[model samples]
Structures are given as C-alpha cells and as structure tokens.
Target: MADPAGLPPRLRPSTVPPPAAVTRALHAINTCTSAAALAPLRVHILREPALLRSTAVISAFFLACGRLRSLDPALVLFASLPRPHVFVFNSLLRSLPQAPACSPLPLLRHFLGLGARPNRYTFPLMLTSLSSLRELNVAHSQVAKSGFARDLHVRNALLARYAACDPDLGHAEQLFDEMPRPDVVSWTTVITAYRNHGHSFLALATFRRMFAASVAPNRVTMVSALGACAAHGAVDTGIWIHQYVQKLGWELDVVLGTALVDMYGKCGHVAEGVRVFSKMTERNVFTWNSIIGAFALVQDGEMALRWFFRMKADGIRPDAVTLICVLYACVHAGLVDIGRKIFNLIVQGEYGFQPGIKHFGCMVDLLSRSGHLNDAFRVVEAMPSQPNAVIWGLLLRGCKDHGDSVLSEHVTMQLLELEPENASHYVTLANLYAETGRWLEAHEVLKWMKEKGLAKDAGWSLRMLEDRSSKCISDGNFMECAL
Candidate 1:
C-alpha cells in the first residue's frame, strides 16, 4: 500500500535500512509538498530506529516540515533523536521561523542545553526569530561573544531586523556606518529604514551614496528610492531611476512597477505612470491600485473606473485599498452617484470589507464635493465609528461652498467642541460669521479666541494640513495619502 507521501510499501523504511531503499525514501521525504505527504514519512522515521540516526535523513525531514509549515512533526522527530548533530538543530531552527506559531527561543535554549555550538549561519537564522528589542540586543551580544559579528550574513540579518522592523534607526544607521563592507542588501535595508521613518531626504542621500559606491541597487533598493522620491515630489530623481532601471534591463515586476506608478502619480505625471503601467507584463492587486490611483490623481475618473473594471476582469479581487482608490477617484471627478454605488459594495459585503475610517473619509469628501451636504452629514452619523474631525471639517467646507450658513454654523460648533484648542476652527467660525454680515458675532468669536490665547492663524489650520497630508495627485489637492 502507498503512504500519504506516495512512498510505496517497498520504499518504506525497513529495520535493515537498505542503502538503495533509504535513498529512495529520502528522495520522497525531500520532495514532500504537503503536511499529509509528510505525516506517514514521520511515522516511518519514528518506527525505524536506524533512520533516526542519520542526520541527513532527519535534516531532510525537518526541511520538508518547514516547507509545509508542519513544525509539530519536526518537534516530535527532534525529541526522539538522541545526541542530534548541530546541523540537525540548525535545520530545526531554520524551520522554526516557517512555523508561524512556534517561537525559536525555547529551541535556542535546547540547542544551548545540548552543548551544540551555533555556526555563523546559525546566528543569522537565530537573529531573524528574535522580535523584542531586548531579545535583539541579547542576540547581538551572543553573536559578538561567538565571534560571528563580522560575518556578512549575520550583519545583514541584524541590520534588517533593526531597519525594517524596529523604529529605532539609531542602531541601524550605526550598524551600516560600522560595517566593513555593506552589500546591496545592507544598503537597501538602510535606505528602507530612512524612507520608512520619515527621513525621505536621508533615504535618497543613502541611495546616492550607495550609487556612488558602485553597489548596484536591486529592485528592492529601487523601490525604497522611488518611495523617497514620491514623498518629496522628486519626480526628476524618480524619472532618472526609471531610466536607470530601464538601462539595466531589469524586469518591471509588480512591486517595482507599483512604486514607479505611485511616484509619477504623486508628482502629477499620470501620463508617465500610465505608460509604465502599460509596459509591465505582470501585475498584482497593488499594481492595479497604483494605476487606478494615478488616474485619481489626474481627476481622470473615467479612466480610473475603466481600470477598476479591468482589475476585476483580471481576476484580482479588490481589497479595501482598491475601494479607497476608486472612491477617491469619484471624489476627484465629482462622481457622487458612482461613489455611492462603490461605497454600497462594502455595506453589502460584496468585497467582504467593513468600511474603515479612510473609506468613510473618502465617501464624505465625495458627497461634500458633489454638493450633497445632507448625505455627507448622514454618512458621518451612520458610520460605525465616531466621526473624526476630518469628516466634520469636510462637511463644513461643503456647507461653506454651497452657502448653507446654518449647516456651516452647526459644523463649526462641532469642530470647536472636538478640537477646542485648534486656532483654525476658531478662525473658521469667525470667518463664517463675518461673511454672514454678523460683525458682532464674528468679533465675539475672535474676542473669545483671544481670551483663550488662541491666535487665529489665517489659511493654515486646514490648508497647511492638506498640503502636508494630501499630496494626492499633482497640484497637491486634498485627497488621501498614497501607498
């Protein structure tokens, strides 16, 4: 009879452990594609005491477990073996990360308990399993003590943990500076660290240094560089990067392609973004979102809607983010009817997404921009979560534009109540009153502002916020921030 691993009864481990039979069984174990395929193999390994002695056999089984994320069987196998080799322990350690729920700490302790010394490769693998700051520091100290701190693989892993995961870039930057020779991964990680931590210019500077040092940036590195360019509206830099990538003949895969699309869109070069999108041979949901976002930036609602349908046609299910892009596109083109329908898709569970704050904000902006003041206000009230100041503020802008003075006063009072100390809300209230020819009330609000030491900063409370936050498609109009 054949086992779940498709190991025939003939290939099953025998007590004698024939060399040819064992080799065939080992091949089957190595090629295991699923947990069901590995389960019976585990039973055979446990039954045949002779097979348990071969570290090669044990390591292959553990690797299969890692591949299938079946760590429990590997743990059982590890427990059965006496005096397991360091390679066997390392194999289990390598698999530890693949099993999402398993923690590596206990296994590391086991490795230490068995007096098994971890090699240079072991430190890198071990470092990836550490999450907390204290755990990371302790692991690094152990690496230094073990004399593998100078190892490039160990160094890159530590650098990545600090740069990519942790917010503390001080040590990450320090690690990069101290590295005797930082490779592309090292450079890419440092660049990513700076870009992610709000240091856009610093990230680009690191990229330039990486470029000058002749360490060629890979696709991941380019993604970080493009992101920095997008944040600072450095389209010229982004264009140069795109040309450089083209010159290098690198494939515009989904990730790199999405970064380029977002960059060009944020810089108000949607045409360039569309061209990049058309050139790409492969795309994912993120790629679709970026292209749609580019159209949203240009206020090209029709194009955005067309790409939205095409994304569905391509069989990529729309995520919550995709909905946000399309909804914002509706806001840009004042397509209230279309925006309402798209928002309904979420409420109807068509996309299986509960609308989030960002989604509600987009809808509010759409209704507000289209002069559906009451509907926008109703959405704010009906949303699951409490309406944030942005929604109230968006509605207030609509009221002001449509000259609904009564609605404006109501919104203004709500804003004042929510943000009692915000000078802009006070300024808005005063401006509304003055514009209504109610000089007394305007002066009274301004007087009250002075009493509270709230200086009425003109045109900044909301406008400056929109400037920094809504770097949405060219002209930096108010829209949600890009990915």
Candidate 2:
C-alpha cells in the first residue's frame, strides 16, 4: 500500500505516538522558524488524525503559519480539522490582520456556525477586520450580543478600531466617556484618535486629563502625547514629557526616541532633538529618518546631507522618506547638482526605491528653485503620474520669480484648467503679469477674478509718521504750540 503519510519512498510514518511524544512534537512545531521546516511534523500529525484533536497542536500550527504570514495553508489546515476548538479559531483570528489578502469575517462566521463561542480575545481579533464605519457598527452589535461588550480588553480593542478606522471621533469620545474604569490603553486610544484626526490640541488636553486622573501613562500613551505636542508645537509640554520619561527610567526605545526627535524638531528646537538623538543607545531606520527630517525642517541642508552619508556608512539603507527629506534639504540649500544625483540614484534603483509623486514633486521644486525651469518642466513631463497642483504651483512660482511671464502664462492656463475655481491660481497669474510690468494684463486678471466672484483680499501697508514736535525739539526749534 502507498504511504498514507505522503512522505518520500525512503521514509515511513511512525506509529501513533504517546501523548507525551505528541506534546514534544507540538512544541517543536510551535518553535519552528519556518513553514518548510514544519512540514514533516504537519504530515506526521495528518497521518495520525487523532493528534488533530489536541487544541494545542491545532493552535500551534495556525500560529506557525501566521508567523510565516502564510494564510492559505492555515485555511487548508483549518478545513482539514474534524472539529476545531476555540483556540484554533482564535489563533486564526489573530493571524488575519497580518494577512492583508484574507478576510477574517468569513472565517469568523464559520467559527460561529460551528457552535464555537468567542472569548474576550476572539472579539478583539474579529474587530480588527472591521475596516469601515458600517462594518464597525455591525461588529459592535456582535460584541454586545456575545456579552463581551464590557470586557476591558475587548472594549480597548473596539476603541482602537474606532480610532484607526472611523472618520469621526464622536463615537470614540462617547466610548471613552462611557468607560467607567478606563485603563491606560483606553486613554491612549482616545488620544491617538484625536491625534490621527488632526485635532492635536484635543489630544494634548486628553493627555492632561489622563495625567490628572493619576493613571500612569504607558509607552504607547507617551508616544501619542508626544506626537500631539509635535503637531501643535507644544515645546514646553514636550520637554516636560521628556523629563517625565527620564524620571520613569523608561528606556528610550527607538520608537519613543524617534517621537522625541520629531517633537523637538517640529518645535524649532533641532539642537535639542539632535541631543536626544545622539544619546540614544539604539537606533532604527525611523530614528535616522527623524534626525534627517529635523535637519530638513530647519533648512540645514548641509547637515542633512552629511547625515544621509553617515546613515549609509552605518549600513542603514535609505527608504523613500529619507530620500524625500534629502531632496527637500537640497531644495532649501540650492544644491542643484546633488539633487540631480539623488534623483538619478532613485531612478536607477540604487536604493531600491520607486519615485512616487512626492519624490517627483521634490525634484520639481529643487530644479525650479535653482532656476532650472526647463529641466523642472521636463521632470513633470517625464513623471509616470500627472503632476499635482503643488508641482504646477511650484513651476508657476518659479516662472514668476525668474520673470518668465510667457512660461508663467502657460503654466497658469494648465493650473486653471485643472482647478478652475482655485482663486490662488488666478492671483498667481496676476502677480506674474504685474511683476512683468504688464499692467493691462494684470488688470484683466483682476477683472476675471472679480467676474468669478473671487474677491481679492484687501492689501494693507504701514508707513512711519514722524512726530513734528519731536523733530522740532531735536532740531532746537521746539515751540510748545499746545500743551
């Protein structure tokens, strides 16, 4: 008879192993570094279907597949199970988010249909799959029906889901307010939701409230708060957080260190950011990017480029973000030649990067700033995607700065076509005409602006008026005409 274990002809499946032996094999499978290495044991277990009854074996296999990020095999294993327990379902649920291609909802439905009940961990795993507000509402209903609504862990997961997926923060706020015993994770999620939605002030306010409540913040909480400080330019508060971090003896892990660097840099304190960066015992690509970005933000192009070289020398390859920062620095410093070299490097895949729109935008800005208007136009023409308004705006601004009214007119027409109702484009065109001494054309633009109901913003100017009495006193001709 053919080998039922599906092994090579030279190999044979062992007899049904003792429970202790099965336990040892399960441990081996759990600790496996790769899916390929786990195959033989999987086949061995398949040959002895009795081993599949053990929840540990099933969970470990799914976990191993999850670790490998191989979800299809996990699905096959799941289907082959005669009766999958909650552990198996939970393991698969945990793996779903990592597998972008697979939807967890179907598997979740299957689990429920099999008469398996979800535990606290189950709802959180299921909640991760809810990508939209509608989906979230449905999942929230499920949580309530399953009686896991009040579970702190599940509630925290729901909070995170809303924070990450929902457009409006109203629901997240309501959930936060409803939590009578909100934990650190709950506070962090609410703060993060505000920060993500660009309400930095609110995020900071929430952080202060959390502090007042005496619930000690965790690493995640600090990161979110620091991000808010960075966005809102709350340097004093950021400094306080930095001091608090030191007081708590929290090792400045790469993530927290990067956040601090970003906060200080955005607050116009690049020197302090550098100080924190230099003191870090460990660093990642994000750390390098943060420091590079700090230099870019301060318009210190030379230092930014210097750090770029240093990052390469230290064996940290530059990603798209790093390249963008370097290009921005080049633009600010007018490093035309260096910018071209960097652009070419990206085109040639020197760092394995594909130039996205932002990268192309940077190139356009760099070239236009250097008075290479023709070269900048050529870059826009060569872009894989259409140039966005920012790119055209850069070109038009360049034309105006360089007194190229003809090119400015052409770019303005394109801008107008793309964004017909954008008043700024008309203003820019009018400014170009005015700069070139084309008074009639400028007036015509003003007329068009008026016709379009784009009211020109009122201009204000100030002139110093000399006090005649003071001047007369200074000149020794003082007469107190009226006391």
Candidate 3:
C-alpha cells in the first residue's frame, strides 16, 4: 500500500496552557529553535499520554508544527491515536488554517467517525476556514444542527465569517440580532461590517445602539466608528469621538491616532489632523501616511512634502501608499520639478524598489497637468506594464486642456484601442477635433460613432452647487466630483 502523499510513512494529527504542566509542555516545545532541536521534543511529546490529553499542550504542539512548516509530524501523531481527545482535534482544526490549503474537514470526519463530539469552541475555529458565502451558509447550518448556534463565541465567529464572505450584511445582522447579550466584540464586529460594506450610516447607527446598550467602546470599536464618520463626512461625530477619547483618558496609540488623524484629514480639517499628529507620542509609517495624505487632500503640496521629509527624519520608512500620496500632492500643487525629483528616485529604486504603475500614473499626471505633455507621453511609453485606459485618458485630457490637437489625436487613438466600447472616448476625440477647427475630422469621428451604434452619455454628470456629488447619468448614481 502506498503511503499518503504528505505522510512520511507515519503521521499523527494534532494556546496558552492554564495548568503548570500544560505551561511546561508549551515551554518545552517553544525552547526548540530549529526542527532538529524540535525533533527530540516532538518524539517525547507524542509519546507522553498526559501531554496529548491537555487542550493547551496539544494546541501548542500544532502551533510548533505549523511554525516549523512541519505539520506532517503533528498529523502522524494525531492519526496514530485510536481515539484522540476533542482538544487534539480542535487544535488541528485551528492550526490547519496556517497551512492555508490544508482543510480540517478530513480530521473532522475522522473525529466524528471515532464517535467523538465537537463542542461550541470547536465550531468557531472551523468557521475560520470558510471562504465563500455558500460555505458560510453551510457552516451556519452545521452550527445550528450541532446545537452551538446559541453559543456567543461561536456566533461571533460566524458573524465575522459572514461579514467577510457574504456579499451583504443581512445575514450578519440576523446573527447579531439573535445574540441574547452581545458584548463589545459582537457589537464591534457588526459595526465594522456595516462600515466596510458602504453602510456608514448603518455603522454609526449600530455604534449608537452599542452605546445605548451601555457597552463601553473599546479602541477597536472607536476606530471603526471614526472610519464611518470619515466616510460620511460626519466630522461632528468624529469630534465627539475625539472628545470621548480624551474624557476616557486613553492615550492615543499608533492605530487609534492614525484613524483619528485620517478622519480629520478626509473631513477637510487639516489643522485638526496636524494637531492630532503632533499629539501622537509614537507614529508608524501608516500614521505618517495619514497626516501626509491629509495635506494632499487640501492640495498643500509644500506642507505635504515637508511632512514627508519629517517622517523620514523621524526614522519612519515611507511605504508605497505614502509615496503615492506625496506624488498626488505634487500633482495637485503642480510642483513639476519637485515631482520629477521624486519620480527619479522611484525610477532609480532609491526606495528599495522600482516604480509601479501607480507611481508612473502619478508622475504622468504631474507632468501632463504641468503642461509637459511630451514628457508625460515618454513616461507612459516607458512604463513596464501596459498603460490602461485611465492613463491614456488622463494624457488625452491633458492634451485637450493644453490645446495640443496633434498629441490629443494620438492619445485618443490609444484610448479607442484600449476601450473600444467606451463611447465617451469617441465623443472626447470628436469634441477635440471641433475645438481645433478640424470640422471634417470631427464630423467623420461622430459618423463612425453613429455607425458603431455608440452614443455619448447625455448629461454625463450634472454638477450641483449645493452638492459636490455629481448624479452621473451613465451609472445612474451620485459620485463625488469637484467640477
């Protein structure tokens, strides 16, 4: 008989220990720095009946196996047992997620085959593996059938899983509603779900409900609430959260501080964002990104550039997002020489990596908007990846704005090839022809569009004075636009 593919002829399948013995078992496992060192310990632990029986001991064993990329040994020990402990099964289920492609379903089947039952704690770990809405539905049913549906921890896991995998929050909300006494984790899960799924108002509403229920918001809960406030431009709500944080005497950590700064930045309160940044005792790359992005939002490129340097001076390495934000700052402020300097650093891999498409896009925007159309054209041509329609479209619009009819026609041809079905590109080219007094070319372009049954979206976007959002007729929805 051939050995199982992954099992080296023999295999057994497999947190913190509460007991001193369990703790010692974990320590024994942890002390092994390498697989060779772990091998002796693995042999001892697998043979120790007492260690295999303890929940934490076995869980740590699997974690050790996972850490060493040696789950096969854990599997061998697990399979060798005629009737493994429930904790042993649960441990394997939890740790298998680390392997990603390894599913715990086979272990589950074997456990059930041994006539062993999974408890409430077991289902939560199992649900972590669910990757699709269908899988979530199936797990929820299993949770119900196994009589663990009412278990709060299990239900919270299910709620999180649903939020992650489901298209909408309807199912997650149902789970939240059915919870008898939802705790901070429960409320936070739902609040975050609402915020993530573009229901900022509902997220805020859920936050309010969580507040009214007398469940004190944790740092995590407050962060999600602030995110909702940011999305909807509810600066007032953000202010309230800021004040509440102050009242609570909670010092601003990197994550909480970043979220607060980002909320203020997105809401157009640059000074407040700066004040928050100054108050932060420690700032990571993300925190710096937020404050710099705040400056970018307000088109204060010089200030953005100042902070960008300050971040590096403070020993924080700027990430790709930070560079993107700073580049956009240059684009908005039309700081051509400054933008070019930064783009050069990107091209030379000064930041430890070559420029990606987004960096190139920002550089192109900076050059084009600064009326350096030919230079922008060269950058696009030199891009490692194929230029998408958006890149071409930006250059085309730049050509029109600068009255470069010749370059505009060339850019439009690229756009036409890239997005053949897009009628707006056709219309733009026709409009450009007419603008340049090429009436015959304009008429011919329009005629070709007509022959292709293509029509430009009438009233592409209706700009409203009271609302910056344009009610786009093309998509039948309002999208934010500033002119």
Candidate 4:
C-alpha cells in the first residue's frame, strides 16, 4: 500500500514507531507553538500508518495544520483516510477559506460521495471558500436539496455569502425575502451589504425598516448603520442613532465607539467627535485614526500632530492610515521639515511598515507644494513604481502656482504626453502662460486646443432679474448688454 504521504512502499518509513511513541508524538503536535514545530510530528504520523486510523490523532493533526494555515498537508492527511468522520472534515472545511490556492467545492463533493452526511457547520465553511455568485448558487441548491435550508446559522452564512460576493445584492435580497422570519443577523447582513457596495442611502433606508419591524439593533447593526451615515454625511441621523445606543445602556465598546467617532468626524462635527473620543475608556488604532483624520480634514494640523504624538506616548503604534493623516496635517501646515522627517522614518522601516504608493504620493505633494520642484521630481524618479498621473499633475500645479514658468512648461509637456487627449491640460498650460503675461504663447495653446477639436467652456455672466431670480447670459448676450 502507498504511504499516507503518497510515497511508494519502498520509499516509506521501514519501521512503524511503537504505539506509546506515537502517543508522545501526537501530544507534541498538539502542544507545539509554531508551524515549524509541526514538521517532525507530521513525519512521525505519516510513517506509522496505524496512527492515521486513530480519529483522535488525525483530528489533532488537522487542527494543528489549520492553525499553521498549511492547507495542503491537511488535505493530504484527509485523502489518506478511507473514511473520515464529519468532525475531521469540518476542521478541514474551516481552514480552506484561508487558503487562496485551495478550493472547497471538490473536497465537499468528495466528502458527500463518501456517504458522510454534513452537519450544520458544514455548509457555512463550504460557502466561505466560494468566491463567485455561480459557486454560491450551486452551494445554495445543495443546501436546499439536503434539507439544511431551514438551518438558521447555515442560512445566515448563505445570506452573508450572497451579500459579500454578489455584485448587485439581487441574490442576497431574494434569499432574505424567502426567509419566513429573518433575524437581526439577516437585517444586519443586508444593511452591511448595501453599505459596503456604496449604497449607503439604501443601507440607511434598510436600517429604518429594521427599526419599524421592532428588531432591536445590536452593536454590529449600529456600527454598520453609523458607517452608512458617515458615508452619506447624515449627521442628524447619526446623532439619533448615538442617542438610541446610549438609551440601550450599552457601554461604548471599541467597535461602536470607533464607528461613532468616524461618523461624527466625517459629518464635519469634529467637536462632537473629539468629545466622544475623549470620553471613550477603550480605544484602538482605528479610533486614533478617526480622530486624527478629523483634525486633518478640518486643516487643524497642530491638533492632528498633537493627537499623533499623544497616540505614540500611549504606546499605540501608528499604522499606515495614521501616517497618512499625519502627512496630510504636515502638508496643510506646510511643516516641510516635519514631513521630511516622517518620510525618512517610514523609509527606514522604523515602525515595521513598507510605505505604499499613497505614502509616496503624499511625499511628492508635500515637496511640490513647498516649491522644492527638483527634489519632488527626484523623488518621483527614484520611486520603485512608475509615477502615476496624480503625481505628475501635482508637480505641474505646483510649478504653475509658484511661478516657475521654465519648469511649468516642462511639466506641462510631461502631463500632455501622459494624457494627450485631455483638453484640461491644454487649458491649464494656457492659463499658466496668460498669468505670466505670455499672451502669444497662451494664444498658441488656444489655437492648438481648437485644432484638436476640444471645445472650451463658454463664459457666462450672472444677472439679477427684476423678480429676484438669476439669469446666466452667454458671451454674445453680455457683449450686447455692454454695447
């Protein structure tokens, strides 16, 4: 017979270890801290074919593999078993979601073929592994056929899968409507789906319907609702939700509190956001980011920096989001020195973070705005990734604003090369020339714009009518009125 690892009989371990030795090896596998520690135990289990038959030993091995996120080994061990109990299959199913390379559908089909009846836990784990709507529908059909359709947890997982995976929420809504009696999870799932898919208005509307149904909102529901409010800038509705939360006597837990802070901050109620942040006893990195972002949005760079320093003092390390907000503050405050220092810190990997493209963009914007055009261009050239349109646009705008006509012309040509069909770039270059009293160059640009079939927007003059209404007059009407 082939070994458990699929090695040929000749290549397999010559001697099966004793039962006591197998027991000790199993114990070590279960207690091991890291994935590396599980290696020898795996070898021991595979060598002694008798150990593979013990459900207990196999279950422990699968559990250890699940912890290590080593799905291939788990699948191999599962194939070795002639008949795996449902419990062992469930452990394998749960771990499949974390493995991007492995698909759960085939394993599930194989399990069903083995005449192993799936329990309640089976469907959810299987559903998570599926990435497409077609896959979800296939799983849904199976759930219905297997008489597990009415299982609440299984149905909820189905709802979540549709909500999260379906681009249009059509499947999710249909599944929700079919439910005889939908629970809070059902409502929350749909609301979150809408919110996540940029249908914040629909999310708020659903939350209202959920309230009308007399279903009390939980922390998760409130968080989703608040997130929708923030997206739509519905400060009034957000305030009402906050009051409702207070009425429920629920402690402002970190998740809920962070949501509230983000909602208030985004709604332009920075003061209220600060109040909520100050009173919160428990705060996470998200909370700090929200408050700092609020200050950055309002251009309160000083306060943003102050909170950033305070966050560091409190032993909470700043993440990418936090650094982005800090950089925004530095840009608005024109603290180029501080911005440079922060950029250097990120480059040095002081906080164990690799700066993404957004960070690089912020640095470019900072340098360009400070009139360090050459430095900004150098930074762009040195980037590991190609400079995007936005970075080039920033440099062009900076040149135009700072009256560096020589560099402005050069940057404009670069922008034109990147976006040849964009009429706005021609307009910008012409405007820059006009501002610098180069009327001939400006006229040439307008001529080029006309030749390219890009029509300039007609100028209009606002006129107050006798009835107190306003009329926008075109160039011809304005000239006639002047005559």
Model 2 ranges off by over 4 Å: 1-52, 60-83, 97-110, 421-483
Candidate 1, 1-483: lDDT as tens digits? 677897766654558745764686699897778798777998898887667777888988998888787788898878767677888888887877622575676676677677777887787777677777777787878788778889998999999887755776877888889998899999999888888898999999999999899898888999999999999899999999999998989889888998999899888998898899899898888888888888887889999999999999989999998999999899888888889999988988999878999999999888887888999889988899888798898898889888898889999899888989888887788666555655455656666766787764545543443333323323343222322
Error of 3 at 351 (Å): 1.7
Lowest-lDDT window of 10 residues in candidate 2? 458-467
Ranking 1 against 4 by TM-score, winner: 4
RMSD of each: 10.9, 11.8, 11.2, 10.0
- Tell me each candidate's TM-score: 0.74, 0.77, 0.82, 0.80
lDDT of each: 0.82, 0.82, 0.81, 0.82
Tens digits of lDDT, candidate 2, 1-483: 556897556656878666985687687877788767656767776776557777777787777877887667778777777657887789878776532675666777777777778888888887776787777777888889889888999999988988887787767788889999999999999988899899999999999999899999999999999999999999999999999999989999899999999999889899999999998999988889988998998899999999999999999989999999999999999999999999999999998978999899999899888789999999989999888788898987887678777888899988988998877677676655545545455556666766777644422100001133234334553233122
TM-score for candidate 3: 0.82
Please estimate how well model 3 matches the true structure, expressed as its whole-model Cα lDDT.
0.81
For model 2 the local lDDT of residue 398 reads 85
Clashing pairs in 4: none
Badly placed stretches (over 4 Å) of model 3 are: 1-61, 70-77, 434-444, 456-483
Quote the lDDT for 184 in model 1.
98
Backbone Cα, N, C clashes tallied per candidate: 0, 0, 9, 0
In model 1, state the lDDT of residue 86.
82
